[model samples]
Target: MTYRKKLIEVALPLDTINKESAREKSIRHGHPSTLHLWWARRPLAACRAVLFASLVDDPSNDLPEEEAKVERDRLFGILEDLVKWENSNDENVLGRAQAEIMRSTGNNPPPVLDPFCGGGSIPLEAQRLGLEAHGSDLNPVAVLITKALIEIPPKFAGKPPVNPESRGKIGNEGNWRGARGLAEDVRYYGKWMRDEAEKRIGHLYPKGPNGETVIAWLWARTVRCPNPACSAAMPLVSSFWLSKKTAKKAWVEPVVDREKKEVRFTVMTGEGAPRDGTVNRQGATCLVCDTTVPFSHVRAEGRAKHMEQKLMAVVAEDERGRKYITPTEQHVVFANKAKPSWRPEAELYGKAAVNVPLYGLTTFADLFTNRQLVALDTFSDLVSEARKEVYKDA
Candidate 1:
């Protein structure tokens, strides 16, 4: 089945300050080292205003060290304010619960899904609101964290952090085990290589970038054949193709001169052409075997000129020639299989005509269910409408 086109109006939240206010705040808080702190605090309108005013109101004769200390204090105050808000009712419990509920219901609420399985903050909130919630996470730790937060037993509702020493020991043990296993694997692979064709193929064994061994012992075992006859026992040759000079003589085009105008021609020749009598108008002998070409062949017209040139240039050069001209250039062409044809109707209508129906907008209310969906839809619509109004004013 063809998928339905979905158009979504995604609205991002607005910044707390206008450009003019932001500029003023920047000037008020503009210390060389405190720019980062200034920008970070700008998201919190109250904290930003306080910090900005403090920087502007400071009456000390601006010394570099004094200014730095002031900036540091301002940043610390901002951070403290942020921490308080982050742990407050609006950001901590309520916000988390709302998010959890939305995630469980998929922004559409129940009869769509249970609102209070206590899987996340949302589920716990759902339970508090007299609904059932459900959720899942791939990470076991995340699952535990969520469960602990939502299913807090009466005695363990608030607890201190885990002991640092205990956590450190566990982490250290895991790291040690991993390192030991890696070392064992390396030792095993090294021993295996020594036992197997070490004398013959030791030089060919690969090494890591830092000149240290990298391939594990188990990996080397897989590459080795248990059946001796099927093993790669042969020595690895450097190259199989002809040397550069020989290849050039065999494949490249020869130069030709016609009516004082010289043009190079690419011509394929048989092995027999070297022994046959052929020569160009110039007295130059064949570049391959040094054989003299017959004048009749060189003077011959059309296709014969190419054959005669190939005979003289490539096939007839001397095997022991002290000086040789080799073709210095090469070019490569890449080709792939032809693409399948597009539908004629689709091609005629153009992209815009097809895209309109494909990307048509959709409402969350129509697509989802329950109070969670309702809340999310309302929030999204409010944000979108606000953005539209802002853009219209701009």
Candidate 2:
């Protein structure tokens, strides 16, 4: 039989049978010819097999070595290029997938949609292929990126406007100021406080050349806020404790006992006199904002025990003593006793906001659009009519 005839006969009801199950059946039946034909039709399936074999099979096997290396190289090369593009610019996988589909469909690319369009890959590719592409994504970033990639002039390629003076600038003197400003605006305030404190107390907490002082500098300089509002100010908060002897690296209040000439630290509970081990009393105030938390909030040793044990004990006792007092009277009694006499004063550090870029891609539903599918169904009819108009002899 001809290749086309054999293909039609041996296609194996792919529409009804799952590909994996069908592949397994073929292998069990020992139908090498059918397997070869199936592999030939699905290049992606072959690629996957190559990947699996490379991962599972022995490396010393000589015959598979060259093929394995080739497959690995091909996969890595594609991934590397994709990653480079993503890193340098704001492109995404959907755009790449849409481009592949467009290339497969020739110059007249089909309209595409990306339901989960992340970074707008498919729709952008469809637009480039002269097809109207629509996209949507759950992520705001994805939607924004897709719209930007699709709307921007192809010449611009979604790159930011270049600053001539800023180009090729590196190191602290060149572009460092701007980068540092961004870091400070979005990253460094907490560290700044810790550093100022350490400078004042480094002598009390002395170490080798790369000792406690250096470590403290590194630690103090790296502190950041955990709340997203403060994420823009810093990536992470610095470690305050010089050693792990302190309980679980609590936020500590640090103070210089000027009379004793010794630096001391305490767990910051945002409450009454620093816990049992608290040594520091001087508080650190924010310079950018007027907020002042005990230096403890920034310290590593300060425990975050916001509630007092006595208060909890009183609450529990009241709850257990409910039989003695009526519900209405109980509430009044609890209210009077629950009021705190002294509360710790911790100031709110200003939070920073950071902007993230997003991308757009395509969805399966786009390929099955009522208008596009209708167009495909009637395509042959339109071609036949055109042919009849042009030629009388056939």
Candidate 3:
């Protein structure tokens, strides 16, 4: 049987589906796509509509004009039900729609395949419409996401996902099945990982000066002064403001001590207009030797000729949204012990036709500070430990 209903005829109803899908996207409370941020994802409604239209036979086909009109109305009714099922996640309606498609296609619809499934939207929609779906992507992150969306859930459908921490205890909470136990295990392990990470390096992430919990910390790249006579290094940050709040504004100002040949960072706070001079987007001038330093001199420029300095997260924001920038003298004192030697994932290439050495960032690890690395490593190790403890036999 061939589909005889023109796609344009169903465009009106599809418009309704599109709008509802857009609304769902804005507040996706339990959507599977929210698990990971994927680039250039397609709309699920469009995927569903395309898959349904392709797989099912058009109702107006192989009928008299009078009967075709009746069939057309019935088809629209089914489309309305499909849209309703998609919005409400009603499996029964979905099953009935799938059965209708199977009947139309003589139960011989081919399994759908998406080779460049960045976020598995098409494959997921195909599966929702009761079609066997397969997806693949060059990106490992995308592959993992597609597997989680299209492979894992169905494989462990009836089975409860119980990690080691909640395996035995979940039974006491009454008939914990399917994803419920899995969610419990996730939450339990999540808290455990955080606690373990904090226990190891909590001191490094200091609270805000206002006695509020620290929300975020900002770091900057540092480089040594080119002048050999005054070999002083400083953080090459453009701006030091942690908050742009009109009344609660705060920023860091560099106090250059020409006599001592060093720069001191002071955190100034009050209700005042933003000082344009406070932000130095250009390369910083050396405080001691009165030498102009460009960004190229501080970054990884050539073979073993790059400036050496530790990365420090010197600025922080509190839970109350107050800003606090660390004093340069006090913070830089810890620099000697805070050396981070994390390597790059891959060598960065420059756009220049000439082959430049160490043109840009080389590794992912080189981007973070010592304390951040420590925290990340600790958290990673704890996750591995938790997994091993939970799934030792499996």
User: Which candidate ranks first by TM-score, i.e. highest?
Assistant: 3
Poorest stretch of ten by lDDT in candidate 1: 217-226
lDDT against the true structure, each candidate: 0.31, 0.33, 0.63
What's the best-to-worst order under lDDT?
3, 2, 1
RMSD of each: 28.0, 26.6, 5.8
TM-score of each: 0.17, 0.22, 0.66
Tens-place lDDT per residue, model 3, 1-394, is 4335653344436666677667667776556667788998876766776777676665556677678668766765666667642443576777776886787777987899999999998998888887889999998999999998778776665565566555566464566544455566556767777787777666565454555565554554456677878867655655555567777777766667866766666667786532333215565666557577665665443234454443333455454444565644434444334543443345444453133444344446555556567666676678789887567623
1 versus 3: better lDDT goes to: 3
In candidate 2, what are the lDDT values of residues 77-123, reduced to their tens digit?
Answer: 33333323222232454344334334334445445565865655455
**Deviating ranges (above 4 Å) for candidate 2:** 1-103, 118-133, 138-142, 153-394
TM-score for predicted model 1 compared with the true structure: 0.17
Ranked candidates (TM-score, high to low): 3, 2, 1
**What value of lDDT does candidate 2 attain over all alpha carbons?**
0.33
Candidate 1 stretches greater than 4 Å from native:
1-10, 14-145, 152-155, 159-223, 226-394
TM-score of 3: 0.66
RMSD of 1: 28.0
